[model samples]
Structures are given as structure tokens and as C-alpha cells.
Target chain A: MVNNKGLLIVISGPSAVGKGTICKELVKRGIDNLELSVSATTRRPRQGEIDGINYYFKEKEVFEKMIEREDFLEFARVYDNYYGTPKKNVMDKISNGKDVILEIDIQGAKQVKRNYEDGIFIFIMPPSFKELKSRIVKRGTETQKDMDKRMTCAFEEVQQAKYYDYIVVNDDLNSAVEKIYCIIKAEKCRLSRYHIDLSGFKEEL
Target chain B: MVNNKGLLIVISGPSAVGKGTICKELVKRGIDNLELSVSATTRRPRQGEIDGINYYFKEKEVFEKMIEREDFLEFARVYDNYYGTPKKNVMDKISNGKDVILEIDIQGAKQVKRNYEDGIFIFIMPPSFKELKSRIVKRGTETQKDMDKRMTCAFEEVQQAKYYDYIVVNDDLNSAVEKIYCIIKAEKCRLSRYHIDLSGFKEEL
Candidate 1:
């Protein structure tokens, strides 16, 4: 019998690549024995957001203290707000045989990769840069200058996808989810992650 | 657009472990863009066996000459019979983007590993040695001494599974087939095997 450990799947993509949507669909499909890691942030919670559920809302001082204590797996400061992944939450879930998905940006994913080399890194990609631009424009949330900056950032992000373990193109939502589901299942069968206990069989022989 | 190359999947297991059944089920289920590699053997074919379908029946001298020419991806001498995988058949199919599955014994698998390091090696496993013995006994084709020899050989074969890339336990035939299918699909998504042409995207950006 092989009692396999859980997998730490780190997902990264540029803005408007549908990484969040794919993750949501995977959770909605009820992937067996999986959990979404909750991230902590120093930003204010939205009206409908609840503490510990939507995000682990933290004060600036408290977030800085945790950072100093090395309690975060990866952290960053953006526009005076700190966002980080809590190390304990991920470690506890994985140790208890729950596959954990960390949906982060490329920079954060790179930092986590340094600490967890065995983690499966997946980069969600748009079908093309043209489609990516269209999607961003369709969102109607950015100015022309903002969109240009985001497109440049996306170009740089897609370049780093070569370093990731796998890349799923987000042309169709359901199809992308199915591809990711297959990747996770196949990864579980990898011999590097599984160790068969042949003691009982040896005894019979 | 990533026009990925086909995968060379090498499947190996102990005798009577249902590798043939799983491969048949995979084909029956219509695994898209996949084919089973035809093996070359010097042994005499049984009744109903076709020249190029079941096996490529070859004369001993021809097989020997092919071996001298290094025409086999892998080959071995079993008793007085020469069994081998022709390099051309596998290479042709894979080069055309058709995934090829090679079902071979452990010894032949090890030889293939040395040559095709990029190929994915998968080991099929019986649920237990006790169940394995029962299955072999149920087949009703082996004498008592022959059965004992097979059981001993199986023990040694299972031990080599640790070197494989993936392991699928054949507790249920359909489940094993599904696991292998997932492995093939996931391998296609691997960043190393797949290269997305970003030159077009670069022009658009």
C-alpha cells in the first residue's frame, strides 16, 4: 500500500488570464481532498467580506510582525498594503493529506518555489496576447495607460511560464479545469511522490 | 500555439498483471492521438496470429542482424526467442505526433530507459502477491514448477518499479486505464515538452 502525501500546487498568471476563474471551477467541481489556501492581507475588507473567510484581514503592524517572525511563506507590499500567504495554514493542510492550491502572482509564486521545490507550479495562459488584450479591455476597469502597462507586465509574465512545471491555456473555462484536474490526478500517480510498502507482500513471498 | 510532440510511454509489469487488458481498454475507449507500438519477435506465432498485427515475426538471423545494426529501441533474449521493439516503428509514430505505448517486460524496459531517457516509464502493479498468485492460478495455463518460477520472477520484477516514473495498481482495469490516460494528457501540458510560439504574441504586443 502507498499512502501518498498531499501536493502543493502553485498557480500563477498575469492579470485577466482567468486564473481565479479556473480555481473557482476546480473547487466547484469538488476536487477530491483539496483546499484553497487563504491569504492574509493588510488591506481593508470589503462590505460583504468576512474575516478569515474572504481573507485573513490583518493590521499593518500585525502583518509586519508576522513578516519579521518568518510566519509567511511569501509576502509583498503593494501600494502600502501587505499581502502574504500564511505558512501555518498551508503546512497544516498538506500534512493532513489535503492538496492545497495557492493562487498567487508570478513574483509570489517564485518566492514560494524557492522554499518548496517539490511543489507543482502551473501557469495559466491566455490563448494569445491579442486575446489577452481583448479580455483586459473587456473588463473596462483600466485606463489606456494602465492597460498598456498591464500588457507589458503580461508579456514579461508569460515569458516566465517556461520555468513552470505546466501551462494550461484558458481558451475555454471548462476545458482548462478538466486539464488541471487531469494534471493533479496524474501528479498523484508519480512514483517520486508515491512509496509502496512491500513489507506485507515480501512476507507472503 | 504549442504543437507538442507525442509521448513514448513504456509500460511494464510482472507476468499476468493485466498490461494487455489495460492497453486494450485504452484503445477501446478511443484515446485520441495514441497507438500501440508493434513489437518484433523471433518466436513462432501461435494460431490466428498475423504477420504484422500481433507481432512482426522475424527470422532469427534477421533479428540478429537488426540487433547488430542497432535498429531496436530495446531488445532482449528470452530463452531461445529474441524479443525487441523496432526503433523505426516507434520513432515514426511519435515523430508524427502520435503517442505510442510499448508494453514490455522489466528487462526490456530497463534497456529502453537507457536509450529513451525522455520516455515516460510506467510500472503496473498487482494489488497484492496473494491476489497475483490467485490470478495466475486461475488462468490454468502453468504447471506447478512453472507457476513457482513465475512467482519468483514476479517478485523481482515488482522491485524494479521504484525506478519508473509512474505506477498504476491494476486493482480495477478501467481505473488503471483512466490513470494512464490522465498521465498522457498531463505530460502534454508539461512546459518542457510543450513550447508555445510567443513570436506572434510578441508582434501583437
Candidate 2:
């Protein structure tokens, strides 16, 4: 029989490409033995934000120490906030046969790729340029300038999709979620993932 | 939007590993746009076996010449009977957007592997050595010698599983078939399979 380790599913995409929505739907649909990984952040928790649930809220000094010790799989400084995904918790869960999903940004995904070669890097994509622009427009930001800046950043991020292992377009929420779910199941069958012990097998007639 | 090409799925395993049964169940279960490829043979067909349906029956001279011209993807002569898989038909269907599944012997699979680098090579395995032996025994082979030979062949063939990209243990028929099906769906999402055109996308905010 084949004994497989749980996959570290790293999902990212252009800004507002619905990566979070797809992950939520996958969890809601109930994939067997699946878990969402919580990230550690140095930002102060807002109202209703639960530490260790929403994020492992850490002080700047402690977060820096954790980084020095290489406790995080990936961490980034974005607009004065330090965000990171804790490595130990994820690896521990995976060792215990739980597939962990990490919804992170492109920078975080790149770092995870370097730290964990076995992780499944998935890029969630919009159906078209028109659709991507429309989705951003629907957000109704304060100024056209802000929206334009976001759009340029998204274009740069879209190029990063080439680096990912798989790409699923977020045209239909359920379909995209289903594709990711199928990927997980198929990946479990991959030869690289399993320690198949044929030692128990005999050549007896 | 992403445009994916059809995949060439080559399924093989040790003798009596039930690769045929798995492929049959997959076709019966109706995966979208899936087709089974028919092989060609120099041996005469049995009663009720239709030419071009069961196989592309051919003359010895013709078969040999075809082999010379490299028309077959993989071929072998077993007990003076030549059996081969025609490459053109499979490629045509795949080019037309139909995923093609080929169930062949381990030797033939190896040849296909050399010929088709893009093919999805799947190795089907039994639950255990005991199960493999039991399955061979269930065939009610005429001689203990024959059964022993088959068991030995199966053992040799299983070693080839290491070269495959994926291994599906046929512990349960439905589960195994579903795993292969999921593999197809998941493979469609692979970055290598799609020529994703981001040109159709716009950066407008």
C-alpha cells in the first residue's frame, strides 16, 4: 500500500482574482482531511480579529526573532505590516495526514516554492483581461488613480502565474473549487508523494 | 481563458494487475471526451471480433512494413503473433480534443514512454502481494507452472512502476477509477498543458 504525506497547497494569483473565494468553497464542500493554515502577522488585530484563529498576532520583536530562527516558511513586509506563514504548524499537520491550504500573495508563494519544493503552487486566474478589469472596477475604489495602480500591479502578478504548477481560472466559483479539489486527490496518487512499500508483497503463485 | 489540449493516458502494470478492468470501468463511467484506442494485430481475430473495431487486423508482410515505416507507437511479437498500437488514430483523436486511454502491457508501455514524452503513464497496482497472488490464482490457469510464471511476471512488471508518473492501487475498483478520472481533470490544469493567452486580458482599471 502507498502511504502519502499531506500536500502543502500554496494558492495565489493577481489582486482580487478570487483565490480566497475558491479556497473557502473547497473547505465548504468538505474535502477529506483538509485544513486552512493560519498565517502569523505583526499587525495589530482589528475588531473581531482572533489571534491564532485569524492570524498568529505577533509583536514586531518576536516576529523578527522567529524570522532569524527560520520558524516561518515565508514572510513579507507589506505596507509596514509583517505577514508570514508559520512553517512548523503546517509541517506538523501534514505529518499527521492533514492537507493544509495556504492562500497567500505572489511574494509569499515564491518564498514557499523555495522553502518547500513539494508544495502544490496553484495560480487562480481571471477568465479574461476584460473580466479582470471588471472585477477590479466592481470594487469601486476611492479614486481612478488607485484602481489604475492596482491594475498595473495585477498585470505584473499575472506574469507570475507562469511559475506556478497549475492554473485554475476563477470563471465559475464552484468549478474552480472543484478543479482544486480534484488536483488534491490526483496529487495524492502521484508517485513522488507516496512511500509505496512493496516489501509486504510476495511473488508467490 | 485557458485552452487545454487532450492528454494521452497510457495505463499499464504487471500481468493480471487488472489494468484492463480499470480502463473499462473508466470508460463505462463516462469521463468527458474520452476514447479508448484500438490496437492492430497480425493474428486472426476470434469469432465475432470485428476488424477495425476490436483491432486493425493486418497481414504479416503489411505489419512488418508498417513497423519499418514506424506507423506503430509500440509493437511486440508474442508467440509469432505481432501486436501493435497504431499511433495516427490516437493522435488524430487527441488533436480533435478527445483524451485517449491506452491499456497495454508493460513492454508496450515502455515503448510508448519512449515515443511519447507527453503521455501520462499510470501504473495500476493491486492492494498487496497476497491480493496479487489471489487474483492470479482466481484466473484458474490450467497449470501451476503457468500461474507461477504469471506471478513472476507480475513481480517483474511492478518494478517498472518506479518509472511511471502516477500509481493507482486498485484496492477498490470505483475508488481507483475515480482517482484516474481525477488525474485527468487535474492534469488539464497543469501549466504545461495549456498555452494560456494573457494577450486577451487587459490591464485597464
Candidate 3:
């Protein structure tokens, strides 16, 4: 029997919905209580990115081997790199009282939720598609062509909002973060987990 | 399709657990947005108790007739008084976006949960059984025997703590109310009802 079951929170959003930034803030506030599940990737590390911290940087051969051995809970290829989550580490952390946060994409989130029915999925969205496009453009990295592609991608992500356990509109940073915090706090108190004994009823009566 | 489904929150505890006072504060805090479910009882009204507001004062035959017609969600006899919840009012309020608050005993809470899977049950416990007993005694309505019976009832209620979606310890009134408030606010953010569309994925790729 499990002494304590940890909750897995899968967070997904479009590229510029500020999921990463808000996650960093969540971590800064006190994520020591939660284990941030880092993904293993075959992509080359960008400048100033640490190997393990940024990702479990792995060779294509090694990444493929894990897939062959069925070591990953879920894996997918995006752009030119293969990304996957290791199952054992996440489960162990959760069983040990650390809630695990998985900042994965929508596809990966759906896959995880299917396999782990208990996991909570949160989908973040911009206030409006126009706002989303503006934020993506403000990043200053995408070319005009690339910007169009990303905005199109964001609209698609917004459509997946209904599947999430909660939808957090990243209209304002503090408000969104506060909403997420409230969700977590409330989930902790869910009645399904409470063990009430009615033996006292018979004795009292 | 349901236009708006209101949430059902069951607040239950032993006598002197401060459930009544806390619920009062919660109502004052705009839970009027949630309709407070007044129970129907066959007991004669005490002075100043309103006919339909405080409770639906009923003749024993009328109460029995309603029970026979399956008009109640749950009902029980306590000290020769018949008490029950009308099934219609709750369903009507929920369909109108008014969350329903049921302040009942633990037994009623458990029964309601069994019938209404969507019902959210919250258990309020005093700091300890000893403290609970003291409070009940200090109320002066109960003799030693009555106090003992109440303590026994409380112990039984506490055992059902695990049955609730949330547990709030009423050590301090303000903080406990705040905690309850947070739980309710956060529950609204649960992902089950909310949806985010990911159709953007198809467009981008």
C-alpha cells in the first residue's frame, strides 16, 4: 500500500504563454516541495545551457535505446530533436511526498494523463489570439514567416483548453500564478482522500 | 446539455466544531452566490425560527408522505424529529449557477455523497476531541450525559475525516474560514469542467 501518493501536475501552453516564466516563479517561491521533471532530449544544447539542468542531453543512439527498452513514459519528436520523460524518477519522487511538475506539450500531457489517470493537467492560454500573436512577435527571435507559423500553432493549442483540469489565462502574471496556487491548495483538500470512520456512530448511538 | 451546473458543498462536523459559525462567515463572504440549502424537519419550531428560512417546518405525516414519494436526497430521525433534504430545490439551484451549501451531520454528508457523486464534502474538526467536548459543555444546554453522547458522536464524525474533499481545523475562526474560502475558490479551477482546445496544433504543423 502507498503511504502517500504524490500528485503529478502536467502544465502545457503555447510557446509564449509564459509557462516557463511562471514555472520559474513557482520554483522560486518554494518548489523544493515539488520535483520538476526534466525531459531527456537529443537536441543540441544552446549557448549557456547546462547539460543536465537544461535537459538530460543524450545522443540519438542512447535516446533510441531507451525507447527500444520502453524506459520512457512518453516520448515524441519535435523539430529535429527527440524528447521523452523517464517514468521511474517521477513515480519515485511522487511516492516520496514530492508533487511532480511536468511542463510538457499538449500531446505529451494527454499521453501522460491517459496512462496516469490521477495526474492533474493544467492548460495555459493567452487572453486572446491577437495577444498571443503579439507576445510571440515580441520575443524578437522569429522571422515573419516563423511568426505566422507560431501564431497558428497557438490557436491550435487554445482549442485544447477544454481537455484541461483547469484553464489559466495568462492575462496577468500575478493573477495567473495566484489562480494556479489556489488550484493546488484546493486539490490538496479533496474529500476522496479523507478517511472517515463511522464506527463511532454505532458506538455513540 | 446543462447550461451551468452548480457545485454542491457539504459542510459537516460534530456539535461545537464551529461549523455553524464558520458557515455564517462563509455566507457573509458571498456564498449567497451559493444557495444555502435549508433542511426540512418534523420537529416543532423553537421560538423565532422562520417557517421556510431556518427550516421547512413540517407535520410528521407530511414529512412521511414526502419521504414515501422519494422526494428527499437523504433523511434521518434524530431525537424523535424527522429531518430530510428536498431533492428538487438542490437540483434547481445548481442548474441556475447557484452552488448549494448543505450544512448537515457527517451521516447526512456520507449519504449524500453516495447518492450525488458530484457533491463536494468538507469536514470541519475542532482542535481536538477534548476541546470539542469542552465547547459543547460550555454551551450549557447539555448535561454531562448529553455531553458524553456528543463527544462520542464527535469521535465518530472525526473518523470520517478521510471521506471529505477537504478538512478544515477550527482552531482559529478567521483563519479557518479563510482556509475554507481558499478551498472553495480553488475548487472552481479544477480542470474537469474547464476545457482548452488544442486544434492549433493541426494548423501549425
Candidate 4:
């Protein structure tokens, strides 16, 4: 009855498309028994972000050492900073029957796919490119050039949407979140993901 | 952004595991847009049966001729009666953007899988074999011997669980139906199932 192992869910989307917001919704609701996979980064800690909670902030030299050791499952340089997913923690969580979720950029998402093709990749898309621009503008942190760069990055990022397993359109927040949650719940019922020994069951006879 | 395509879903379960009950719940609730794929059979129509509604009943010779012509996707002979799925009708419905569901037996399910490998296969099971037998007895349509024969058949059917994409435990009717509905919704969001064209979109170059 209780034989499911776990699932590794990778979610990728353009910035300002609410990937973090939806992930926080999932975490807050505690639906489908999922745990967030915190990333390791070489970037300095922000004002309020906890070292372990937001990220395992590492020194540039240490991060470079890990990269040389091939310890990170996926690593990338973003906006002059380094970000990588540590292999050990993610694998450990999944192996222990806890569903692990990685909210990653398109590059890291692609790398994870190359390593673990079995992992579920979900792409979140904005309603339209126009709406996408407005969302970024509303954030009030970026210059016009910064906004342009992000939009450029988004166009290239969405090109990888075809590589994803699921594409959730983030038109409506609640509906989009529900779709992602349902996907997770439904995926848990997959027979291939379970630990059942059907061959040994008396039903075989 | 709007492309209409149909999906074929194959659902199977052991006798008295309440496949019909759960499917009816889904249909009644209009949870997911799905059309039931009624099969064609050569067996004599029992009392209160509606031709074309319950089944597309055909003469034995007609069924045999169709089988000879390879028109049936999968055909089987049981107790001197023939049963099969019409490939043309199912394909037509699917191509028109209708999701078709085939409630089938283990043998038929295997045959459909062999022919239509892209179809979604879902297997329903009771919480335990004890619960299964209890359900059969509660039905009151079978004698003790009949019940044993059905149980034996169920045991044999359970062996095919490994071949299915999903194994849903029918512990609670409402929950099982909800899970099935979620699976359908989630599958529609699959990148492989649907695609969007971004060519017309204005983006920062």
C-alpha cells in the first residue's frame, strides 16, 4: 500500500513568470509531499536570505573546486554569479522517499535532463510576451536594459520548452498551481515509480 | 495556440474492483472531457441492453469477417463469442479532439497496448485481495463457485499490473476518480500532447 519511492521534479520558466511564487504556494500548501531542492551558489548572500535556507552560499574558489570535482549535478554562470545544484543532497532526498523539486533556470534544467532523463521537467510560460514585459516592469528592480536582457533570455529559454515533459501556462495563478500539483499527485500513481513486487504476489498464480 | 487533438485512454481492472462505478463518477462530474469507447461484440444481447449505446452488437459472421479483414484493432474469442475494438471509429474520434476511454479486460488491454502503444493505460486494484473478494460477494450476482472463478480470474489479471502506466488503488471511490481526473488533466498539459507557436510574439531582440 505504501510502496512509492520518490520523484525529482524540475521546474523551469522565464524570470518574473512566478516560478518562485508557485513553488512557495506548493510548499505552503504542503501538497503531494514535496521538498524544495535548495541550490548551491557562489554569489554573496543577500540582505535577508538565510545561508542554508535560501542557498548554500559558497566562496567562488570553493564553488570552482566543486565544479572541478564534478560534484554539482548542474552548474551555470548567471549575471556574473555562479549557481549549481549539488548532487549529493538532491539524490539523498529522492532516495529517502521524499519528492525533490528543483526550481532551476533553463540551462541548469537542460543539464539535469542530460544527467537524469527520467526526471519530470515542467515549463511555466506567461500568457503572452506583452504580459511578460509588464510583469518584469512591475518588479521595479531592473533598468530598461536589464528588462530587455531578461526578455531576450526568456525568448531563448522558451525555445527549450519543447524539451520539457510538461508545459503549464501561467495565465491564472490558482489554476496553474493546481495543474502542477495535480501533475505531481497523478505522477505518484505511476507503476514504474513504485516499489511493488508484482512477481512475488499470489496474484501471479 | 489552439490545436484540437484527441487522446486514447485505456482503463482496466479486476472484477468487482469498481471500475464502472468510478468511471461513471468521472463522467457524471464532467471532471475531464472524455468520450467512452464502446466496444463491438458478437455475444447475444442480454435483457435491458441497448444496442449501439451499451455495445455495437454484430452477427457472428459479421464479426468474423471484420476480424478476417483486419479492421479490428484487437479482437479476441471468448466462450465462442468475439469482441473487438474498431480502429477506424476510435481514430476518427481522437483525430477530432475527443479523448476516448476504453474500459477493457486484461487480455484486451494487452492487445490494445501492443497495437496502440501511445495510449495511456491505467490499472485499477482493490486495497487488498480480501477487499476484492468481499466486493464480489457483496454484488450477489454470483454463486460461491462463480465467485471463486471470478477471483481466480482476478488473480490472473493482477499479473498484468506491471504493464500499465498507472496503478490506482480503489480504496475510496471518490479519491480514485479524482486521481484519474487529475491524470487526464495533467497529461493534456504534457509538452508532447500540445504545442504552442511563438513566432508571432513580439520579443526584445
Native-to-model Cα distance after best TM-score fit, residue A200 in candidate 4, in Å:
6.1
TM-score of chain B of each: 0.93, 0.95, 0.87, 0.88
| Backbone clashes under 3 angstroms, per model | 0, 2, 30, 0
Which parts of model 2 are misplaced by more than 4 Å? Answer: A203-205, B1-4, B202-205
The CAPRI classification for model 4 reads as: medium
Q: In order, what is each prediction's RMSD in angstroms? A: 1.6, 1.9, 4.8, 3.0
* Candidate 2 residue-wise lDDT at A165: 94
Q: What is the lDDT of residue A40 in candidate 2?
A: 95
Q: What is the DockQ of each candidate?
A: 0.77, 0.67, 0.36, 0.54
Best by lDDT: 1
Q: What's the TM-score of each model vs. the native?
A: 0.96, 0.95, 0.76, 0.88
TM-score of 2: 0.95
Sorted by DockQ (best first), the order is 1, 2, 4, 3
lDDT, model 2, position A27: 86
Better of 3 and 4 by TM-score: 4
Candidate 3 lDDT over B87-167, as tens digits, reads: 888989887888888888888887798778888788887776667767877778877687777777677667778767787
| Interface Cα RMSD in Å, per prediction | 1.0, 1.9, 4.9, 2.6
Docking class of 2: medium
Which scores greater on TM-score, model 1 or model 2? 1
Q: What is the C-alpha lDDT of each candidate?
A: 0.90, 0.87, 0.77, 0.84
Candidate 1's residue-wise lDDT over B23-103, tens digit each?
A: 888878888888888999999999999988889999999999999999999998989999999999898888899999999
